[model samples]
Target: MFLPAVVLGALVLACLVSLGTGAADLGLADLFSGSDDSSRILLVSRVPRTLAAVLAGSGVAVAGSVMQMSMHNRFVSPTTAGTSQFALVGLLAVALLAPATSVMGKMLVASACAVAGSGLLLRLLHLLPARRTPADVTVPLIGLMLGGVVEAGTTFVAWRYDLLQSLGSWTAGDLSRVLAGRYELLWVVAALALALYLAADHLTVAGLGEDAATGLGLSYRLVVDLAVAAAVMTAVSVVVVGTLPFLGLVVPNAASRICGDNLRRALPVVAAGGALLTVVCDVVGRLVHYPYEISVTVIMGVVGAGAFIVIILRGVDRA
Candidate 1:
């Protein structure tokens, strides 16, 4: 209760800061001035951008938490486990093959690919000892290696098809160009994040592995459902806002450390933490190079990488 309260409050504050922290001259105070340009910018740009950050953040974090719980591994996520790269491949494939494919069509294909990627990673993990101490590190490395291979392949294909520059946009996680209409699809992610609560209890049990779930009479269907939910969430996030590297991994691990093993309990904390981290990272990106902007991916890579190390060294090791 205490942790969730704190995180939610921080998330609200971070969101307010995000709305005002952009390059355009806008602030919460502007809401009182009634300036049309400020109102326009707030509605057209900052509002959309802030919503995008929050939606993408919560979506990816919950997806990551579900994946970790489903597989009983804390370190694996769409970024580390090749799911985002696979989504990228699917999106690229659609762009190249069906030039007439609509945005919704691209999301469907990308989500299917992300599901396959997640399933493949889960199968591979089964071949390893489940939840061993060494596995805490080994699992992510294997997933990252798998992702690297897939990403390299995607890069080659995109280059051959002369879509490398376009690929750069989806892979880079930039929020600078997000306008109102452009980011409306992210609301789908918000809805998906909410659905996690419905399945939280089952996922927590299934995450304990087959024997434990069976002993408790928890249907394996919940496991597959969780996987699909996470995959779709991951795919939608990548398609809309580019891949926010380490967001899923960093936030959930932080939540688990504070909130313990209960999925239902930890989930709110994960969502808020995810939103806060993203909003803060974006604000830092805007301020770090005033007048110019850095990509949120760049900011997150530095910040999340440091947090990832702390989690591995202190959080997991101590646990």
Candidate 2:
């Protein structure tokens, strides 16, 4: 109760700050006073952008948590674990092969690629020896290496086709252009969040490894469902707001540290904490350049890298 309250409060505060921090000269007071068309800005831009951040951030965080649990590794996420890279691949593919595709069409394609990527990762994981030593980075290292290879390939192809600029826009998260009609895909993300919450118990059991889960009468199929959910979560967020690097990775880790590994207990905090972190990053991005605006990806990369280092050191020390 206390933790959820704190996270939700922080989220609300961050959202308010986010709503008021953008360009076009809108303030919180202006929202109510309807000064300078601030109310219009609030509806058309600020509100949509903030909501997108919250939904995408929370969705990706939950996906990352599920990814970690299913794979029995704490270091992997949609960003670090090849999910977003494959999503990028799908987006680029759709752009190239089917330029006439709708937003939902692009999402479906990216999601399919993401799901295939996760499947490949699962198959690869089976070939590795199990260990949890302090130096054990087998899972994340492999996932990173996989994502790097795919990302490089995608980059090369995009470069060859002169789609690098377009690719960059798709990969770097920018909410400045997120207007009202552009962000409704996040409602689907909200639904995914609900699915994760409802299935939290099964996710918990499945996290104990397939053999354990099967012995405990948990259907192994839940692992597949978890993978699909994580993949879709990553894809939708990417399709809508671009890839928010290290967001999903670090947010779940923070939630686990605060509330232990239980999904039921940790999911709420993960959602709110992710939303807060993202909105705060967006605010930082907006403030750092003033009227020019920095991308959320830039701010997230800087902050998430620092947090990643801290997490690594802490995990090694504790192990």
Q: Which residue segments of model 1 deviate by more than 4 Å? A: 129-135, 315-319
Q: What TM value does model 1 have?
A: 0.94
Q: Scored by CA lDDT, what does every candidate get?
A: 0.84, 0.88
Global local distance difference test of model 1:
0.84
The model with the greatest TM-score is: 2
* Model 1 Cα lDDT, one tens digit per residue, 198-292: 77888778866678788998887656566788889889888888999999998988888778778888888888888888889898999999868
Q: Which residues of candidate 2, in runs, are more than 4 Å off? A: 131-135, 316-319
Give the lDDT of residue 308 in candidate 1.
84
Per-candidate TM equals 0.94, 0.96
Question: Model 1, residue 149: displacement in angstroms?
Answer: 1.1
Instruction: Supply candidate 1's per-residue lDDT for 80.
Output: 87
TM-score of candidate 2 relative to the true fold: 0.96
Each model's backbone clash number = 0, 0
